[model samples]
Target: MIGALLVMIWLLVAMLLLLRRSQAVEVVPSGSPDEAQIAHHLLLDASPTPLVLVSGTTVRTMNRASRLLFASDDRILPPPSSLFDESATHLRHAGRNWRADRVEVGDRSVVALIDIEAEERTAEARASAEMIQVLGHEMLNGLVPIVSLAECGVAAAEAREGDSALLGEILTTLARRAEGLRRFTEAYRELARLPPPLRLTVSIEEMIDDLARLFASRWPGVHLSIDVQPGLCGEIDRDQMNQAIWALLQNAAEAVEQGGVPSGRIDIRATAGDDVLIIEVADNGPGIPPDCAHTIFRPFYTSKAGGSGIGLSLARQVVQAHGGVLTLLEPFPTTFRAQLPGAAALYGTGSVF
Candidate 1:
């Protein structure tokens, strides 16, 4: 009788086990494999751009593409609020052509995307624009001199003096414009051939102080404030970082020139949290115009009547090289932020690098 009871108990246990397995499969998405089996399936599917399947703030699973794309996070992904809260989502959709959709899988939310293609297209467009800016710069230089020459000829005609050298004025104007064009072309070439950062360990705080002092001297009228915590540093290319931050600062000053004091504030803050360092340079100026947000980082695309739009693009490239990111705070009191790893971490291809 005891032996018979034992056999019955075993059968009941087996049935309960089967029921649990069935429930697990039903709740799992059809397209998603068990995350445990991800290692063996790496080659089966490929994503062309950086893709991350972020569930809340945690990355439940990442395909090969995501691993490569968000490598710097190394171990932990950023907070959900950082990527897709109301503010981020609005900025994403407001002025850009990119898509950011939320998908429900099981009882959780996942963000799926191929962001790199959009990035590449943006880069290519900027490159084309820089080429055009160079051309425009050259043409204006030539035309300016010609315009001056024409003015001189008119003046000479009115003077009716044999010494009124119309040819001389025209030649001088043309020559001056030609020289202007040459200088503009030289600047274009330097931007085009900008070298990849020679990265090393450096304290970002020191860099900020350097910027503060330099800008204070340059923009005597503008207040350049710095609030960086102690012992915060990153593995970066100093020259590139300087160039990136300078671009943002210069843009901020320009944006506030016509606006009132409410737009005059440019704040730079850095905090070291856990193993990461996040830096922000914020301005209260007339934030990026809706249309400008989409193309602001593109090369040669400038909204300023006298500006060349290559700064932000270079900034983005520098950030990307550091295995980091630089993004505009969309619904902001007008801010730009950069997220980079701390000095101890070195970037790797499939990891954070």
Candidate 2:
């Protein structure tokens, strides 16, 4: 009787276990992976651009292209904000250029990287080639005539006395051409040897006042005005700042003149925040053409026939050297803005460079 009871109890336990297994199987919906999930994985794997998914600081998933484009190690990827927020930001990984954008996938973030190294390198190579070409053309333009005339002068001096007058003329012409070439070369040297700013407390109001007067005297046809807050000052190299501002004003005047507007208007506005000083040099003229905007700041690029194209480029270099930025603003009122950190702000941020 005891043996029979034990068998019945064992059978009851087995039946309970079988029922639980059946319930567990029923809990899971019977289907393949969700279509959306499959499509998402497919999109990431198939994209030629590098893609990586991240959660917090940890990279959760990366496409195959990420391995080929960037380092296999994930630590090199920049934070999502740097990649997504700044449109001008360029990323370098594995000696290649990459640009990234952020995408949302439920609660996670995805970073999509595009390799732009080829395009960037090509642009740099083209610009370098163009610089070489311009240098050759300019040098030959002066040298060829100078050499020919020198040879002619030598022959004339040896051959006859009658050509003395003509020889003198050739010599004078040679001197003039040589002087012009000297100036041209000097400008390039100056650009290359731009001295670091001598940080000194400078009065913005005084600077603008001086600049306004100078512009008014120089460009009689243009109406120049200044609007600067009183007691505004910044720590900058006074001389270099003056030069950069002068270049900006000169460019504005030239643009206005080109637009052929009688009595063209140029407005210089200065304002300072707790951390930065903002200066806007604006003119009422035809704004920069969209196509040439990218190249205008490049060295050796000029739309003006007599322009050396060094002025604006040199000015920008100076501003950059001072840990500031100069950029042309878009839309109407044709403006170029210069943003410089205040002396105290620079010290606070430890961005003195």
Off-target runs (Cα >4 Å) in candidate 1 are 1-164, 260-263, 343-353
> On residues 9-66, what C-alpha lDDT tens digit does candidate 2 reach at each position?
9999999999999888834354546766778878877777777766665663377677
Residue 220 in model 2: shift from native, Å?
Answer: 4.0
Best of the candidates, lDDT = 2
**Ten consecutive residues with minimal summed lDDT in candidate 1?**
344-353
- TM-score of each model, in listed order: 0.56, 0.69
- C-alpha lDDT of all candidate models, in order: 0.67, 0.78
For residues 1-353, what per-residue lDDT tens digits would candidate 1 score against the true structure? Answer: 99999999999999999999988886666556686467445643365543445554465444555455455433335533444452343223223333445566775555555354577798779777766876777577567767877777667666755465665766676677667667666766766787877876777677888898888887677777788876566767888888988998887777766555552777898876666668888877667777678777766667776776667777877787777888887625678888877554233322221
Model 1 vs. true fold: TM: 0.56
Model 2 steric clash pairs: none
The root-mean-square deviation over C-alpha atoms between each candidate and the true structure, in angstroms, is 14.7, 8.6
